[model samples]
Target: MTLPRLFAIAILSLTPGLTAHAGGKKGENSGISFHLQGDPSDNPKMIFEQNTAGKQVVYRRNPDFMTKDVAAFNSFPSQDGQGFGVVLQLKPSAKNRLAALTSANIDRWMLAMVNGRKVDAVIIDKQVEDGYLVIWKGIGQAEIDAFDTQVPRIGEKKPRR
Candidate 1:
């Protein structure tokens, strides 16, 4: 079989809900929000957006998870040597919901919007049962500072109420 066809078959086998369309656009906003890819058939519930590539993509209007769901995080130098990479640990409730979302949306793309711009787009290759999401790269130091103010670093003690 052709490579692309084999790839499609593989993805379909892995994710029963897999579809042919997957893409997104940048947006204007502060902080971070992760949006899930939506099929064109979901027009009523989806919105048009532009991905970093300048390609039009359809995605859900509401993020599957957002900054409010973050409990802690860790940042690292990006492998690409361009910017930082952030590893976000979700709150318990968000973690459970993320597990369900990732489990069901395998092979779909998840767009990360930081400070209102499209910073990264990741393919949901597997279920994220641990409730951790990584923005592989394209994160600036300014954004990292913002994240620091919003959520504690992983392993850091939470302040008393």
Candidate 2:
């Protein structure tokens, strides 16, 4: 199978109630993907993917290593669906939904400038190449920062065993 096809499969495998937007066509199954990037010996990683239906899929394949339980604190939509100067990918009322739902582990974070001042912040830890993938969503800045801090840095060399 092609790489994109396999990548989609791997993502689908973790998302329980979520479905890929890719057209359901032939040769769409049986593909391999590296859910998380790391040596698996040090600085292990976690993976989470979701669909529009709020069905979250998760996976952890740290070879010969242990992982901490992924704690979810929030998943509410941004206020006004337009925080940080960008529209939220979720629905307008989704932010309220996140605020209402107690099961969702999500949080609200802020993008700030260096004002030489201490302000509320949120740090989402994950291998963020383009968009926030794994380490899906946390509730507040502290939660996001705490969880994100656990993610390994990109291209960071692993420690010797």
Candidate 3:
């Protein structure tokens, strides 16, 4: 392979890894990429907007666990003040912090059921809170069900004192 071609391939491959760390000020989780927007100041904002035309699943850090999961994720604003959000906890939080970036849209934030049960996919609607909202989909029904139940729970670390 030519030197120039080899160099090009190397850069292209590393591109994903580099972008993965982009704006990682919040956390580093695997199988997750988010398209965020809107300020949390508002009650309900377009937190996670989906780009794909197909259905999507979205997850946000549970508001109740904001201060709890300080290192896991951070809170922003809803920008609208009338939206709700769901938290998503990656099994291996240290696997792939950044996979691929997606486009966010209004009214794409939702945690609904696909096969008669609540799923983790947020759908990237405009009813979610701001901060770092990830839009994921094509997940199994079982996994989605789990996320719907308590994936957002940022367990309280025992008192350090």
Highest lDDT scorer: 1
lDDT string, candidate 3, 1-161, tens digits: 99999998899797876656668733433222333333444344323333334644333332212222222321222334433233443333222221121233454444422222232344343333333343233344344344433233345332211
All candidates: TM-score: 0.75, 0.17, 0.22
**Model 2 per-residue lDDT tens digits across residues 77-160:** 445442211112222343343333312323322222111111123332322222221222223444334433443223333311
After superposition, which runs of candidate 3 have C-alpha atoms over 4 Å from their true positions? Answer: 1-77, 100-148, 156-161
Q: Model 1, range 31-136, lDDT digits (tens) per residue? A: 8899898877876746656564567777787788889899999999999999999999999999999989999999888998887677889888999999899999
Candidate 3: lDDT of 131? 35
- Candidate number with the higher TM-score (2 or 3): 3
lDDT (Cα, 0-100) at 141 in candidate 3: 37
Local distance difference test values of all predictions, in order: 0.82, 0.29, 0.36
Model 1 TM: 0.75
Pick the winner on lDDT between candidates 2 and 3. 3
Question: Per TM-score, what order, best first?
Answer: 1, 3, 2
Name the lDDT of candidate 3.
0.36
Clashes (candidate 3)? 31
lDDT of 2 at 153: 28
User: What's the C-alpha lDDT at position 38 in model 1?
Assistant: 86
lDDT of 2: 0.29
* Backbone collisions counted per model: 6, 19, 31
